[model samples]
Target: MSDPTFSVRPLDEDTWPAFAQLVEANNGVWGGCWCMGFHVRLKGRTAAQNRAEKQERVREGRTHASLVLDGDQCLGWCQFGSPAELPEVKSRRLYEKGLTKLPEWRITCFFTGKGLRRRGVADAALGGALTEIAREGGGLVEGYPEETDDRAVSGSFLHTGPMAAFENHGFTRTRPISPHRWVVTRTVSPT
Candidate 1:
């Protein structure tokens, strides 16, 4: 099949609602996160509450990029920013095991609409991010892709990305922070 064409632009107030809907649709398996599981502390609340909390958090602050759209419809969401912008990631218990250094650009989250899975939307989104980063000509783009020995968790569960997907875009495994989490980096050179 031919690849679908879509554009990945920074999130704007105009597109945030569609992005939220896309995120909610994935919550059935992603567990009501709205892709906020990593960004905000859940504080032992229910998934619905966590979702509500994240929505509030989104309102209170600015995000680097939060919307991915195909024409007028939102198809995916990718949360990224400079390492300093993502203060919450610095305190995640999962990140403390072996991550002593910080990345230049942190890819904290991702979500694709229900109908758009297994499509090339993610690669397109990553490419768009790279284009923007390259244009700025600063910062190393980084990702935390899931690594799994368990067969059940290997598929679909690697929602952020699988090693192959990142590698496919020139990201290399810089370190294995945990058994199922990796520090992946790819330096972008502007053309």
Candidate 2:
């Protein structure tokens, strides 16, 4: 088959169906996270709750993301928002301790179809997010990604995305959130 075309768009009201389909296609992404890993603490919660909460935020215009679309079909996404918007980070207590500076925006999670992994889907998603940030008058952008290593927790587990993806976008390792993960950032001011 020919290489699938790649592109991304901001997740808006019109694109909710595509985003919903993408998450539902993955069975709610990460045991039913519904891409709310950083939006809410998902412990002791059902997948239905996660899905509802995520959709609600989207409707309220509180959540943000860049959707990697293969021609109207969303195959991947990069979740981002202000620090206050995505307060429930994975290693919150730990990640916050080292957060000396609060970023204007934070890139919290990423999801790509199973078949799209090992390709550039996530990279495109990240690029799309940065583009959106620039459009919004670029400021400090933060992200959480685990350092590359031979670990059992790889693949879909790297929801925050790989460090290489961030580095490719000029993000630098700022602090260590855990033994494996880190808080990275890059400034994007207007031209």
Error of 2 at 34 (Å): 0.5
Q: Estimate, for each residue in 91-180, the C-alpha lDDT of model 1 and write its tens digit.
A: 257666666767677876666666677776666666666766676564678888776554556345566666656777899888776677
Give Cα distance to truth, residue 129, candidate 1, Å: 2.1
lDDT of 2 by residue, 62-173 (tens): 8999998888888888999998998877777987787778899999998987676766888889988999989888899999997767666767668888888899889998
Candidate 2 Cα misplacement greater than 4 A, ranges: 1-4, 150-153
TM-score for each candidate, following the candidate numbering: 0.75, 0.91
Worst 10-residue lDDT window for candidate 2 reads 1-10
For all candidates in order, the CA lDDT equals: 0.66, 0.85
Q: Give the TM-score of candidate 2.
A: 0.91
Residue 165 of model 2, lDDT score: 89
Model 1 CA lDDT for position 162: 63
Candidate 1 stretches greater than 4 Å from native: 1-4, 27-29, 45-61, 89-94, 135-137, 148-156, 189-191
Error of 1 at 91 (Å): 10
Model 1 TM: 0.75
